[model samples]
Target: MAERRHTDIAVIGAGPAGMAAALTLSEAGLRPVVFDMNATPGGQIYRQLAAPQVDATLMGQEYIAGRSLVDAFVTADIDYRPLSRVWWLDRDGEGYVLGVLQQGHSQQWHADRLILASGAMERGWPFPGWQLPGVMYAGAAQILLKQAALLPSAAPILAGSGPLLYLLAWQYLQAGRPPALVLDMAPASRYRTLMRHPVRAWHGRSYLLKGMRLIADLRRAGVAIRQGVSGLRASGSDALERIHYRHAGTWRSLPGTLLLTHFGVVPEPQLMRSLQLRQHWQHEQQCFVPDRDATLSAGTNLWIAGDGGGIGGARNAEREGHLAGFAAIASLGRQPTKRRSATTRRLLAARRRDLAARPLLDALFRVPEGWLAEQPPETLVCRCEAVTRGELDEAIAQGGSGPNQLKAFTRCGMGPCQGRQCGESVTRLLASRTRRSPDDIGYYHIRPPVHSITLGELAADDFDNTNN
Candidate 1:
């Protein structure tokens, strides 16, 4: 049998939510084990300092906040395991059986309760020549900037939708090399649609102000900020050289070494889904959300927090984490003080209100129609499988009604990444072609070993089916 460890609470993901939950749980007299795939505590939002001896400024305030939380956790009797990727989780009686791969070895951790705060990923929309070299996701560009302090290119074109585009553009301008051009997909009229909700409008004022500042900076920097880029293509034999875009009903091509595109973010629920946690199709958010109660509990002992629940940004994620921590404490038969319960209730209410804006935002900025229309036959849809959009279309046309059939035929979702990138897109395309809702089509079925593992690692593990 594999060696086993136990803890009062197990928090997966060392991002803001997981770190916050661990700190709070420790304060409440519980020893928590926190696992993260990265080498440090900060999640993607607050990525860890690149090197151990690197100065803290390299990571910025996001990571600094996580570091402070980690410091507090250290004093609270929490066991922090970095660079540990959890691949499999099974419910063991009242707790969970967590399979983690660390240092080329397999291990297990049993916990009285498990909190998932895995966070979100940048949603990718397929476009013409998007697979070309130097064409990267906007979030990837931000990661390069945040972790390496390196600009993607000397003259990059920023194109796509969502708040991250402006934020990244502002960062580039602050770094002295503003992007060559800014092509926004969301028309100005979208804001008028978003204005229907006064609360959302109020909550979004800061973003509007930031966008104004970014526009002003771009103007001063002599960078062109165009309203729309309907199409994006990179034409070059070897490296990226020129970008073709459709702006204001006119097609224009510009010379650029790199192109960064984003269509906002989507909940990363692969781990959660693999655990068989009930998920609801969030039509408003255009993503799948884990089914959770008011207290952030997904079921009996499984809890979730942050953008993994939905895309409400960092502040809302922190509030949800605090609620999950209190709830986990309560689940352990500990009675929280009246004051603490009251505070948690208030914060939960605030989070609910904040998330209410997601519907309008999702509807307004939903992936543009015909976004994938120009996808060439050879354009790779599933990077892991190297399956193209045309291949998927042909598979479906040949009576591949669901993801399973499509996978069997084209191997679209059968790769190392295991459909994280292409599953949703395939589901959407399949549903559209068959005249069915995405929910009816359902998400791809997940099996054991959600993440890829080496053969040696699997062979070494003692599979005790009786224990499970």
Candidate 2:
């Protein structure tokens, strides 16, 4: 049997949100345990900053700033667990139980109150030949660069829309490896729509200025950028050799060694779904986000912070973390001091500023209408099970009500990824075909064991597990 341990409070994920939350709680004289899958404290945004894989100067100032947060977290009196995965979460009476695997052994952690800081994942962007080798997400490439100092041997063709695409391109440019071409899927009309929000412009002036600078730098360095792009696909026998896209009402093909694509990101929802919290479709973000109150409370004895609550960036996530920490402290009957109350107000204001330009950003990078439905029949939707768009359509035609039924009709989400790779595509495809909103169509019915694990591992006792 797994060794069962108990804590007064627990924080999941060691990202910006998690670190801030733990720091706040620790300062209040509470010892909240933190669990992170990464070997280090900094999440993806500040990844590898604690132990630099590349020169710190190459990562830019935004990354360099996170070192302070990681340093503070490392020194804080907290039970920090690295290289740990919480695969299953269960409600146990008044508290909760987390099935965690660490260092090849399983242990159970019981907590009275929990703060879920699980971050976001890149949106699923499926296209013809996307499964080929050398075709990967732009975020994955950035991770490799941060973790291993790896870069494409050849100039890559970066496609799709969102801040990450340009951010990665600029990072590569800074690293002395600019992409061969950039195919921006967002058209001119999106920019025109973005102009409707001038108030947002003032609030998000810093981000806008930074983005403009990145674009200007890339162009000055002679990197090619084309907007109004669509109909992207990759082609090669065994690896990605060429990319095909449409622009200026004409189709063009280009040879490339690497193809990196991004379509923005959505909250990582596997754990939230297991909890069965109320969720609503955010039409702007184009993802179903869990419903939370002003204090970030999702339900009783629980709070959600960071991108997992929605797609707010790191700053917003950090603010939410502090708010959740305060709320959790209040729930534990700790009356807020005047300083804490003032800090809460400041955090709320900062969070509003952090999210002020979100609507404009969302409008500019929104997924195109009928985008999912426009995929060719042969295009794969579920890479895990080799399911195709044609198959999803066939399932819809067969009278399935939603994704759960479609999963039974075809094992699209039953693979090791557990629908993380294809859940959004399936929901959007269903809505597009049936003329229903995604909320009406609903998402897959997620269960426990959110992450894949071996039977032997699950059965092993925590007796010999030093992590316990």
Candidate 3:
């Protein structure tokens, strides 16, 4: 039997958003339980910040700034559960029940009011030879660098469109290891979008300055950067040996042992989707975002914050967390103090300022079109089930209307990953083939057991359980 417990307020994820929410609630005299899948606090953006294995000087200021957040979180009175993965969330009467797996045991947690701050994940854009051993995501590479001071050998090639791709290249340069080449895949359409929003460029000048400085740094470090790149392909007999991409109407080949690719990031939507919450397709960002109100309230007993709600980065996430915490406090029948109200207003203003640069960044880093058209039929779309593009096309030709029908026909999403890696690609492909909006095509109908667990773990009863 699963263990059960209850809390007045609970916050999912221990990233910047969740930590901020919990801290705010704790300061307001409510102890919120925070569940984090990682072994430590500080989600991906601040990973290993508390006990960094790598050098702080090389990681830069943004990373070092997380120390204060993690330090406050550690010293707080909040209940922090590290290495605990919430696999299921269900509405139980007026409350919510979360099924969490930790240390090979299943436990259930109940919360009167919940705040979800689940962070984002790197978007997977598949191509030929992407399944090779030496192919990896730039985000994954950054994680390795942060957690283990690991760097790719043999001068890897970085290919993708996004600030993250360039950020990773800059980090490598800081570590005295530079990439062989950086292929910028941002299409020409990005300029038109930018031109249409000149005001956004002015509002987000700081962001633009930072991006320019990063590019200049890479150039000073002698890193080869190419723009308008497309048709990225990894080729080798076994591991990655060569990267092929098109630039300026010419196909160029670069021999490299590792190929790090990153298109962008999207909200991790499994838990929110499983709860049957409202979602809207964000065309500018090219992903689905959880629908919420001004206070980030999704329902009577739930609030969403951070990248899980939308990709507004760390500062935005922190302010949203404070707002959500205040909202949850108000929902509990407590009137906000005048000071708290003032703080809330300040947080709202700061959040808006933090997000001022978002429109410009979104337009500049938009995912390029023709992804499916550029992909060969043999390319693996769903790496979990080894589903190829041709197989999905055949299933679509056989009257498969949506992701669910295609899953039934081709087993495209029924795997260990459960559609995390391929869901966006699948949705985009269906929308392209059907000439419909992604909103019409919809996302996968996520069910319970968002993360896989063993039967033995589910049945274990000797482990320490909680009921409060």
Please, what are the lDDT tens digits per residue for candidate 1 over residues 389-424?
Answer: 899889888889998888999988898878888878
Query: RMSD of each candidate?
Result: 3.7, 1.3, 1.7
Better of 1 and 3 by lDDT: 3
Model 3 scores a TM of 0.97
Q: Candidate 2: misplaced stretches above 4 Å?
A: 463-468
TM-score of 1: 0.91
- Of candidate 3, the 10-residue stretch with the lowest lDDT total is 459-468
TM-score of every prediction relative to native: 0.91, 0.98, 0.97
lDDT of 1: 0.77
lDDT for 243 in candidate 1 is 88
* Worst 10 contiguous positions by lDDT, candidate 2: 459-468
The C-alpha lDDT values of all candidates are 0.77, 0.89, 0.88
Off by over 4 Å in 3: 189-193, 465-468
